[model samples]
Target chain A: MLEYQDYILTEFNIVLLSSIAILIFLIVLLIFEASKIRSKFGMEEEDIEHRLDLLRHLVGAGKAYLFIADKEGAVVDINPDIQSLMGLEPNQLYGKDLGIFTEDTPGSNVESLWQVLRDKKLPFHLQLRGAWKNGEEFMETAEIRPLLAENSIVGFVVSRIGSTDGEGQSAEGSEELEKAYAKEQVIVESIGDGVIVTDAVADIVMMNKAAREILDTQESEIGKSIYEILQLEDENSAMLLPQYHPLAEALEDERRVMSRSYYIVRNDFTRISLAVTASPVIVDDGIVGGVIVFRDITKEKDIDRAKTEFVSLASHQLRTPLTTISWYTELLSGAGSDNLTDEQRNYLDVIYDGNQRMIGLVNALLNVSRLELGTFIIEPEPTKVQDLIMSVLRDVQPSVEEKQHEIAFNSEEEMPEINLDPRLMRMIIQNLLTNAIKYTPDKGKITIDLSRHYPDLILKVSDNGFGIPINQQDRIFTKLFRADNVLSKNTEGTGLGLYIVKSVLDRAGGNIWFESEEGKGTTFYVTIPLEGMKAKSGTKTLS
Target chain B: MMPKILVVEDMEAIRQAITAALAKAGYNVLQAKDGAEGLEIAFLEHPELILVDIIMPEVDGIEMVKRLRDDDWGKTASVMMLTNVEDSDKIVAVQKYHVYDYLVKSNWELDDVVEHIKNKLKAATEENS
Candidate 1:
């Protein structure tokens, strides 16, 4: 019982000691909590004060304008940048409503931006009113952001946004644009030639008075398709292929189509020939429309036709009288008398041949005039090239025998009955063969080759005599253009032979070219297609 | 019997020349100053062969032939066109009358033309026979 009393006393003493220690610890904790409250409420702690100063300094150092709005929408904090930008002291702006930045409008863009952030609380575009450092009012862009605490709005933060597009469109710029537009309108209205504009899809956007008169269109044609408004024909009086439509082609290529000949049929069914130029109105976006300019060329074409007709009529008249003289002379010389001296016979021969040459020249001129006037009718018939070659050989034989030139003709393939104009083909053969014999030296070689080359017939006339001068080769086929070397040698040549040959070949859908070296040789290459000349043969043959 | 041929021409020289050439070739020839006289003689006297010029004073050759071809007698006779003009349209125009041949005067000598006429007449005779 005594030992139990001792143990109970000891345990009671230990419990008392523990109670005191717990009481002291509770008192110290209460003191610490009181000190923390004092520091926060009355005595500003040095570390926190320093940190706030640093933060202010950092905000001031930034290039961007900064501001803070409190929960009640009053300016709670703002850097010096904002104060300078707003032209107000901190005290003046500190308690003012955030609406001051929004021009005081209840629902201005800046206010709306700030209100939107109440839920979103993210940065967005906002335009705010502010004053310059000199107290002048100006507009600026800012990024408004909401300060949030657990999805509830606390305040707003704003920063100025910098941009490269600082110079907005100004009054002077817009005035200049207006003046340019007015000038363009005046030019479009007063120009002498026709001008028409169409959108990318070929809808007519505008047409000038000249265009209206030329196309015989009313303002009702505006917004109609260009193809729908104007009926078009090519220079050949045939409908244009879609790929060749000027506006369509210009729009597609974004390029200019210049001075193309076409005819527009007016409302009265009268056709007006015109030279048209079209350009795409390309902008920063892309090709928007096309501008077409045109001039009437019908009068010019009539003048040209009249000139060709005059030439044709004059040639025919000259030939009729020459023909009478020629036949009468031939009759007097050939059958009436043979008892003349050698000199007299020679004189008669000169007269006869000179008259023949004059007739030949007139005939050539007539052919050229007919071709140029587009009145040369093509009468295609079944033709044997071999027979034609043989006959031409007979006609040119006297010259060949006089020159004594060695000649060889090779037909690599049996020619079928090819469709061709026998008269024109005869001219081709005579011209080429006559040129061959005339230019060749005595005992020189001449080779004629005609062969079928799958859709074409190839004829090569090569001579091993006086070739065309190298420099003048390009001009060899020009009318009356005799080469320098041949010009000095031969005075009898009229130089229309090759020109006629080239024009006829071009019209007949054939090709002709020559390879010549001065003092060496000349080989002419000619290829005529077996077909397709019939369809391509339009009035373009004259052109 | 010698074949009688009618010649129509505007130029006296060409007309007399053709007549002389034909007479030398042993054909009886009748002459007309223009296409009107040619048409009259063509109907009044039935010549075996008729040689006509293209351009004349009162009636051109094309109009004369186009008119004479409407008659039954003018339709059957072997008519040959002898012309100095070489226009292809006029040549094709004269071809519509079913003439025996169309000849360009300058492109042939008188001797060659005589032979050509003889051959065309012979061909026409064979076709008729």
Candidate 2:
């Protein structure tokens, strides 16, 4: 019996030893698994840190803030740069919601976008007016990129790039803007014509390289008042007042202003004729700044002067011969040569007529040269429009009687004396009336109506004559252009009368237009400002 | 006696034509081819009226008028400017010398010029009376 008990005790000891060994093996397996899981979590943390470092490197020295949040947008970690850019403590941002730093923009909700990112694990961008703990705000462009772990979103990396005071852009957006700005700089610097940009008060904001060279200015002239720096003179070499500056006019009127008479004096005391145009920059219906484009036109002016001198000389040479013909023809037609036969008299009459036509042609050509050269002077005097018209009527009465046309003169009562160049006014009236009488059939109705329309003196010359053809009406005002109907009807017109009239009116800031039909008569409408011709000081008056 | 008139012109045809016309109109006429010769005859003869041409050799019409006005009688002398070229400088300059009329030669007929001179002489006589 004692031997049987010993065997049982030995079996029990072997079984107990095997069971303890199995428990020990299980504990060792659990320890190894736990250690592997801890190592995997450590790798994910290291990956997030590496990504944060990469984001920091990407932002460079830009005013940027980077932070990492959990998948639910709960702030997990932030860079220290947030303090300098956003005036925020990095520690305070930790454990807070990302919504604390960002506000929803119009048309887009940060919470909805964050929800979308969390659900779809996709990256998104938003513009934010970032709010600080003390209620201060900054505009920022924010990008939220999802952090992933093993094919599932783990967290988000939020980077905000913005200005501390004004509007801000994303890192990529800022880079693009810099590139565009550099391109603009290159274009402005490379232009050959002088360009100057001025602020609202006429202070120089930027000047291109060509502008600097033309003005003999240096880089340090920026920010100075443009009027003070740019010394200008008129065509007469008189000092150009600041009030007359094209830039001043452009800014005040908010319209483009152009003038070819401006002469800019450089710092070296040399003068250059400039054709300048100034335009106002308008933003949101308000004038913000101005831009001036100018170029040197001294050589052109010299060539133009030479052309005018040649025309003057040629006209003088031509007039001497014409005057001799006129005097001798008059002498031969007089009673002192009464012995001439009828046929001889008729031949003399024809010579006289041809000579008169030649004189008229020469005069017309001379007037055209003066008009085209822009050398005609405008001398304004206060004169009654009615009296001037009456005098013109008397002068043209002989023609009126010859044509047997009815002249209907209708004028506004109490017409005041308007400031106008009398010679130019006479030219305007004579051309219109004679054209009316010449083109109209004998005894056709010619009407002259003069009235005041406040800012303008309106004149309408209507003729029941051969009307201008519809197809050729548009070219009527062109120099040396005669309507086909007029060309067919009369051979006496120089085709320059209307051109001269239009040029005179244009120089005086007036307008001209006509209404005509194929069979019906034509009415010409002219509007001259009541204040009269713009007084211009020039060298020669229109002949 | 017929009114004495002086014709000064550089162009021979124009000067003779004007002289012949003036003589036919019953005015005693004096002729000079240029302003220098015209001034010599004017200061010596003291004609009643002087018709001066603007562009001439040696002395221009304006310079002749300037020197003529230096004499006591020349200040009020009847003078008319005959010019084919419409020069503003000469026109403006002649205003200071009391020129009676500025006639663009091509624009006026011989009869009109004669009539203008007759009317001008009559007006001067009336003013003198």
Which number leads on TM-score? 2
Sorted into a CAPRI-style docking class, model 2 comes out as medium
Best by lDDT: 2
| lDDT digits (tens) for residues A1-543 of candidate 2 | 656444533432343334334434544554455446458666565554555443443333232336677767788766543444356766767788877767787888878987888776777888755644345454556777776767677677766433222222233466777789999988988899998888888998888988888888777378898788776788678987888899999999989999888898888988999999999999999887899998889999889878867876787778878878888878888866779888988998888888888777777777877776666788889988778788989998998999899999999998888899999998898888888888888988999999989899999999988888888888888888988777777888788899989988998988899998766788999999998889876556776
TM-score of chain B of 1: 0.94
Which residues of candidate 2, in runs, are more than 4 Å off? A1-176, A238-243, A283-288, A369-377, A469-475, A508-511, A531-534
Clashing pairs in 1: none
DockQ score of the complex predicted as candidate 1:
0.24
The numbered model that scores best in DockQ is 2
DockQ, all models = 0.24, 0.53
lDDT of candidate 2 vs native?
A: 0.79
Provide backbone clash counts, one per model.
0, 0
Per-model TM against the reference = 0.69, 0.73
User: What interface RMSD do all candidates show, one decimal each?
Assistant: 4.3, 1.5
lDDT (C-alpha) at residue A139 in model 1: 58
Where does the lowest 10-residue lDDT sum fall in candidate 1 chain A?
A534-543
